[model samples]
Target: MTTSTPSTPSTMRAIASYRGLPVDDPDSLQDIEVPVPQLRPRDVLVRVRAVSVNPVDAKVRSGLAPTDEPRILGFDAAGVVEAVGPEVTTLAAGDEVWYAGDITRPGTNAEFHAVDERIVARKPVSLNWAEAAAMPLTTITAWETLFDRFALTADSTGTLLALGAAGGVGSILIQLAMELTGVRVLASAGRPESQAWVRQLGADGVVDHHDLVASAGEVASDGVDFLFSPHSKGNIEAFARIVRPFGHITAIDEPEGLDLLPLKSKSIAWHWELMFTRTTYQTADMAEQGKLLETVAGLVDDKRIRTTLTKTLPDFSAAGLREAHRLVESGRTTGKVVVTR
Candidate 1:
């Protein structure tokens, strides 16, 4: 997303990609200039303080740029509100906020960004900018998956096997499930470091993801009640075997061309969640994101949940943004990487 016309009288520094090139390529990311966007009714313009890089940033950058204009690629950010649109009432200038902005809009990589107030919330008073920036996107993904899709509650009881349990979403998902519900949590991690990471985060049990059936079965002989896999491309068969009959499975990755026939026999229901869904679809419950974020902020301030910021890259330069993408693409990160202004 780019702006050809200045809605306001100013322009801002931003990192944008003119084309989808490899991360090692010099021109893959460039420091560029863009207009401070005109506010749509209900839009809140923010002075971005810090932004975090997720897998989506690398995935989007590897694809073709959407148009002739440079694409600004980022999702999660922490910032202060500079202005609000004509119809806005929930927030005003000088309010500190955090959000995973709409994927269809110009992203949070810029010095300034505009987002709908309905999906934005007040930042946690306890965290710094980098810490606040790292939580929104991954936290929202885990929150929506557990509450909105799976509908897990305090009274619910079952075993949840989390595949890819060391990544950003799983790191927080384990915390939320452990903190809020009585479910038995089994985390799948392949490496010693990743396993130790999840254990410290309070996973009830940790199993190696390789040979998930054998490993997870040792802990959950009756089969898991719920399965959450962040990487679901080639593991659907294993997912089918480990989950009990009538069990529920949810995934965030686009596991294109993977067969679901294995799941039909047991009547296992598979669901997909994109945290951006409500905002993009313009659903009546779109405002739920802001409310849930407020809840997560309360959790953070009270020290019940924590930010997953593992790495930090200073400044919003081409070098820093490129390294952030490289770390996300490497698939070796335990938590999230952030770039601070």
Candidate 2:
């Protein structure tokens, strides 16, 4: 998520929050001078070329005042490495790289950032910064949701239901499932445009989340083998009814308390996949993130995975980030939004 230090000047221009509140408020985002980090042995200093907005950025901005430091925003970024610390062995200055920065750090909405080599990867050579920036966060989420949480085996002899199948994570998840696994993929899209969007992304079928079970029937009568909900609620009991016995359910959203009693009868397994969990907790698998990102980059290079960038803005200005935040919060965005510097 973060490196110990950086080999650079002491300061850089970055977006930060001095107050915690709604992102629309001018005070919630400000351009500020922050220390250019000094990289640790395993750290790399990146000169950021582009950054992208996600729901976590807004939530983080809202909780800004919780810390004494100015809370900077933006997670996904692509750029060129400017310097590396002594202990770093994987990369050197001038290599193109991309990463979804650690939630515990100052973020990527800056001219320079220091990140651990274990969490950074080579940017796909086929894509530009903006396009590359749109991927890391969503890709990490979707990949982990499928492989880590759902325990999807190599054979993929299963059916998968993807809720919120038109948003950033869903957009990428559908493609990964269809391309990498044999699992039949079903997605939920509330709008006609969204339905068409998911269908184009290689979903076997699209169902309206408004009537989840009915749509599932129209798509597949026997019920799915795995259910993924980016946003979930008490009504998720309906999903329990539709998933096959012993099937797994994975969610990224923080749903309020719900009764697990219903799922017990079916011997269902529930998993929560937070993309930052490994980095945040410093799990032994932290380096696995680097490995996964490299695999994703290869997929991009081979044309198996497409960049999800749908909206682009110029510069790392606070106004641009606010607009990107507004778009993500609106819940109508078809793919990732990037801000180029």
Best by lDDT: 1
| 82: Cα error in model 1, Å | 0.7
Q: 91-160, model 2: which lDDT tens digit per residue?
A: 8788999999898777899999888899999999999999999999999999998888876756878789
Q: lDDT at 67 for candidate 1?
A: 64
Poorest lDDT segment (10 consecutive residues) of candidate 2 = 1-10
Model 2 regions more than 4 Å off? 1-8, 66-68
What global local distance difference test value does model 1 have?
0.90
Pairs of residues at least 3 apart in sequence or in different chains that clash in candidate 2: 5-38, 5-39, 5-40, 6-37, 6-38, 6-39
lDDT (0 to 1) per candidate: 0.90, 0.86
lDDT of 1 at 165: 87
- Predicted candidate 1 versus true structure: per-residue lDDT over 1-341, tens digit per residue: 22222333488999998888999987888899988778898899899999999998898898955467988889899998888888888998889999999988889999899999999999999999999999999999999888877899998899998889899999999999999988999999999999999999899999899778899888888899999988888888888889999999999988679788999999999999899899888999988999988999999999999889988888688889999999989888998899999
Backbone clashes in model 1, listed as residue pairs: none
Question: TM-score of predicted model 1?
Answer: 0.96
Assess the local accuracy of residue 80 in candidate 2 as a C-alpha lDDT between 0 and 100.
Answer: 91
Q: What is the lDDT of residue 234 in candidate 2?
A: 68
- Predicted candidate 2: what Cα RMSD to the true structure? 2.5
